[model samples]
Target: MKRPSLRTGVRWKISIAIAAVGALVAVALSLVVHNSARVSMLDNSREVQLERLLFAQRMYDSTKEPKLGTKLNDPALPHDLHVKMKQGRRATYVQETASGVPDVWAAVPLSNGTVLSLHSKFADSTTIMKDLDRSLIIGSVSVVFGGCALGVLIGGQLSRRLRKAAAAAGRVAQGNTEVRVGDAVGGVVRDETDELARAVDALTDALNERIEAERRVTADIAHELRTPVTGLLTAAELLPPGRPTELVRDRAQAMRTLVEDVLEVARLDSASERAELQEIALGEFVERRVGVLNPAIKIKVVHESWVNTDPRRLERILGNLLANAAKHGGTPVEVTVEGRVVRVRDHGPGFPEALLREGPSRFRTGATDRAGHGHGLGLTIAAGQARVLGARLTFRNATPEGIEGRDGSGGAIAVLWLPEHAPTTTGSFPILKLPG
Candidate 1:
């Protein structure tokens, strides 16, 4: 199941990183500005307090009274500053108040063991700094919000481009070599995403070239061998009838079959290949086909199903699968049918890791030394036919690791699931008698 949103995780991760960086920078800048302003305000308050203390001393010397902000041994003065004054050292102290304001206290030792102290509150500076701090906070928030918005735009663009590239790669993987990441490779070599798009496009081109070359070679070889193989078959028939003649005829027939398979593969590689649909009693048809192919293969119809498919192509696929199993797998191969699905399993060394990982490749058989191997075109041809039929084909080891081909444990299993072409016969098809 897919999520509701088309947005990828990379987008959100990028946006989050941008938002976090913005928030961190804003907080740091706000703190630095706030602290600097408070320190400057305190310094100014201290200077004002000290000047007032000097005036108060002069005022007392002349009129024996203190100024409005100045006092004689003021108890309101900071205790620390008062102690300093009593020790005969002029001092000023800054004190913070709960009302978001601060007071500066200054004192001097007077003659005859008296003290003159002055203190002033930073009332105006407090209100001004409060407004400044509020402005900083709002600006910081705006910065963070703006950064987030920018990040969203950038992230969305990047995600969309990367997805486009990925989609192109997916099409290429599905054998659509014509797909290209043309416009998806946006910008002038700016980022890794753009580079990735270019790389995928290049890979598609290379794959297209390689497939074209392979198709040509396959077609040429198959056509070239067809005449000679057919001639050989004719020659074998003309020879005197004996065991040697039968062996020659069999070899020539195998050569002919190989040539035909190569031609089929080449045709399937082309885009013009198509399926010929026909309705059939799928289980009955499969049972008959299984019997004619090999009498030893055990086949069962679990639930009968009627489907529309190309019977000739289906037979080809089944024939190839059975032949592959009998040649490279252990004895007692089994075939099961349920609905529109058919599974072929054999007891053998199982599929190798390379075969499981990379599906079937031409001329690459995953068989042990005992069972022998073929040209490796069997599974590959079946896979191609499945594609034409719009079916899903899968290969896997039916048994657990290290237990394959041992004590009846299953080895490789190939499943062919055909899409129901909306068969007119909606009900289940009757089960057919299968061969022993």
Candidate 2:
């Protein structure tokens, strides 16, 4: 399974969403608290300064003196306050800085040609507000980080379960019918994910049952028809040599071939066929098969590698490929052996678009010169036999280079990849190339 990108995966999306929401809420709360606290603190400071100003006024009235407090004689007092006092204002207050500290000042003009002023420092309140701001900021950061951590932990678990289910489905698609997502670790929880896993398992089970039933029915029909087909062929052979006899013999032979092919297909579906692996020189094996089929076919040897595989299945695959090329393609068929691979090329009109796209279907022949020669089981059987031998068989239209037909058209090429080691008992065919 491929890992998803961090920027695009569900885990990151979830984490980011949670963190954003948490940060927004945290900031809003901090602003509300800070603004309210600042207003209340400033009001209290103003009231304290007012009480001090009234006290100074009372002392000046009783003693007939204007110098009532140390603040009235302080040099830091703004000149504007004294000017406002001299203009005979009842009371005056203003915010100013004294000795580099924030302070509120209030003044009352006395009849003795003097101003009584009161001052209060706000340094303690300001320090407290700063500390609160710092604490709120730290708390907001902690909340955002905690939300992200929680989101990641939950998202990781959810993604893991989904990935397991997807991987199981992939295995089923690749022909492993026994795979089931419901058999995952951490047990099954009664949730939507569990339901999905169960549904997939049920579907796989149903498909396996239906395929098995079809295989059984096919195998039975083929087995039953074999006896009658053999009898017909025997009786036709006993007939006197003539055109009629030849016709009967040919029809019977065709019937027998069809039945045999059907039976082989049934075996392949049920995996009843097994490979008998043996060590053989790859070059010699391919050459022998080609020699038996056609003497004039060209052979190219790039490497004399050896392999362990089923000789019978290998021959069957090669023979079918060669027959298919000769029937549908042009002349000068070429077989090349390099390492553990064998490629068969024919110079003729290339494979039809339908065949190349949909692959070979049983009894469905390609639209070509040899369209009515035989049933389309040659390539199908070749593919099945290659699978049984733990090899990969693929077909494609040959490239148009030095190999072109008389009509200036490309041909078809079939490639078979054989592993160096024998196929495992479990039928898993992993490609393993041996050092030359």
Candidate 3:
């Protein structure tokens, strides 16, 4: 089924809700009042009939026969109100008599062994009921009509204002940052619109600022690239036939590294660097990482394992770990690898207590002593890359007996545990298979 459009105005919806509630209340109240009035009228009728019986009894007691009670009938009495007896027994009821007018009759048995009846017309009450019925019908019609009219008026006003805001939002979505939502009507009174308007205006201002900043960055990049490209081209044209022209070679190499780093950062920003997954032998990858750093450190290998991962990201992660260890800790950094797990320990003052809890936050480095060498983006980048690859990285202090202030001054240990592939007992491990 198709969903209802959100473009409908809030005023209309609010009005509809109010109308529905009012209608329900009117129905419920009318039912209660009508029933109550009917019950009261019936009770009053019964009471009047009882009163008439007492009056007739009084007259019968005074006189031997019901002769005085028969004279109780008057010209002004209701046609239906007349004394009557059935088989010498007295009875009372509200019913039409021989004259065909509604009346209340009260009957009594006299002490002299004669039946007597008294009746009174309830014409006023019947007329009052007819008037009340007419008034109720008119009142109900008026209530419904008034509620609908009010609802429609309110709904139209709300819808018109909301439409303006929606149009502003549409312009924003279309990249028109300058489009602003002006002061608009909102709330039951006039309470909420100001805040919403201010928020939208602020958002538009921020977006414009960001767009301007990006434009400046783009201009700067172009300016910076020109000189390097010209230098590279000029050096290539004039081949210096000297013994290992170090200056030209170095400049070219430096330029290449700078360009590559810039491109890589751009790729990272765009989220376009996709991992190429392959079944890699974990033992070899770990061993290769530790060996490449070539730190004069004792490295240990544990549990041979395999995992499916991208080699490029793995190499970069390991490079970051080794570099951080080399910079922060003293010589003899210990490297250990087991099934999808790698740990690097340095005999340097362990990560400061504050930074350890903060994890790899910006500018919070474990190696404050080497702060002059490089800004601290290594751990931050590593943590980010690990998250992208769905892996966990953690750090802790390694308190060996000689590692604190004694011999292994200023050392910290970082443990990286990657998930191990679930075992497949049916096939041989990758490394053990015969060469293809």
Candidate 4:
């Protein structure tokens, strides 16, 4: 099954995270620089204001009244500054004026229990300080925006490399051995993603080698046994007139069947094989398969269904599933057809936990009757043929919880879903023999 793609991809996540941190750092640095610059500007202004206050003090004694931004006990003075000056203290304060612009005030206590005050147009406050604050804010925002862009660029490059590697690995898993990392990552420097690509490449090479070796071995063995198996069957036929002859013929036929199965496996593993597909009514097709197998097996068609598939390979799959159910399961075996899907159910104890978990294997039947019969190749052949038909075959034990099996108490059900959507492949006619 294909894994669901991420909604918020890694690159965007990286971009957002970097932008968030950049925004935080930008805001913090702007606050610090703005605060320090504000304080420094105010201190310099305060020194200049104090000098003007001294000059105003000299003029106060001579003029005896306010002039040139000087005043004596001006009622407009802030109440806090007035209280401080009356208490015999020089005071300076800044407050927003009625015009919404800030002004600086200076006050001095006089010997006659009066206070003298001076005001200066809060010069340089309009231009230098306002400009500084605006510049800081703009600079901080620009840094954050630039950082976010940079993060997106870098993250996109990285994500592309990772995505390429993942896609290549997926292709390799699907048996494409030629895929490689090919030095296709961003930046000159190497990283872990590069290493992952290399690893996938190496893994593909190894898997290809192993599969080729196994296929060659299987084909060679089956080819070698073909002539001998034929000879054995021919020899048994010459003596098949009594009980011993019958047993010999049966054993020889079984051997021939085994050899044919191995050859078919080798052929199925080869890439050159292709399926011959035809359209058929699924319900009628399944009934024919059922009628040929066991008249006792029940058949149910939930809906009228038509499918394009290799009837020969599909027949092999269904035949094996039915034979397996008849051998290992209890009575009342049933075949269900719905759409392009077929299900074979048996009323005995469900499949072995090992088979249910890991699927079928050759020469390893999951169960045995009182006679200890079964070669374990039935489901294995079915699964192989199903793959050729581009179908899904799943086995599950029925339980109270759901149809997907875990408990063995409710019997076993094997579901086969044919995919006419995908191009199916098949082989020559089956060996005309039953599997395990």
Candidate closest to the true structure, highest lDDT? 1
Stretches of candidate 1 off by over 4 Å are 1-8, 54-58, 72-92, 95-102, 107-115, 120-142, 183-192, 241-247, 404-409, 422-436
lDDT of 2: 0.78
lDDT (0-100) at residue 378 of candidate 2? 87
Q: What does candidate 4 score on TM?
A: 0.69
TM-scores of the candidates in the order shown: 0.80, 0.75, 0.43, 0.69
lDDT of 1 by residue, 1-436 (tens): 9778765477787888898999999999999999898888788778877887787788888988877667776777777986797689998897888886777788889887888887777788878887998999899999888988888988988888887888777666766666677565566547888677778788777777898898999899999999999999998999998999999999899899889988987887775567778889889998999999998889999999888888998999999989888887777899999999999988876777667777777777764552244778888888887887777778888675566344786677888888866322211121111211
For 111-224, candidate 4 gives per-residue lDDT tens digits of 787777887667666677679878988888888888889888888888888887777676555544565754444347688887777776777778778988998998999999
Each prediction's total of clashing residue pairs, residues at least 3 apart in sequence or on different chains, is 0, 1, 8, 1
* Segments in model 4 whose C-alpha atoms lie over 4 Å from true places: 1-8, 50-168, 175-195, 229-252, 302-306, 353-358, 363-375, 400-409, 421-436
Q: Which pairs in model 1 have colliding backbones?
A: none
List RMSD in Å for every model shown. Answer: 6.7, 6.2, 15.8, 7.0
Candidate 3 lDDT over residue span 272-362, tens digit each: 3455667888777777766776746567777777787667777777777777777766667888888778787787666665456666654
Query: After superposition, which runs of candidate 3 have C-alpha atoms over 4 Å from their true positions?
Result: 1-8, 65-127, 184-189, 234-436
Q: How does residue 284 of candidate 1 score in lDDT?
A: 93
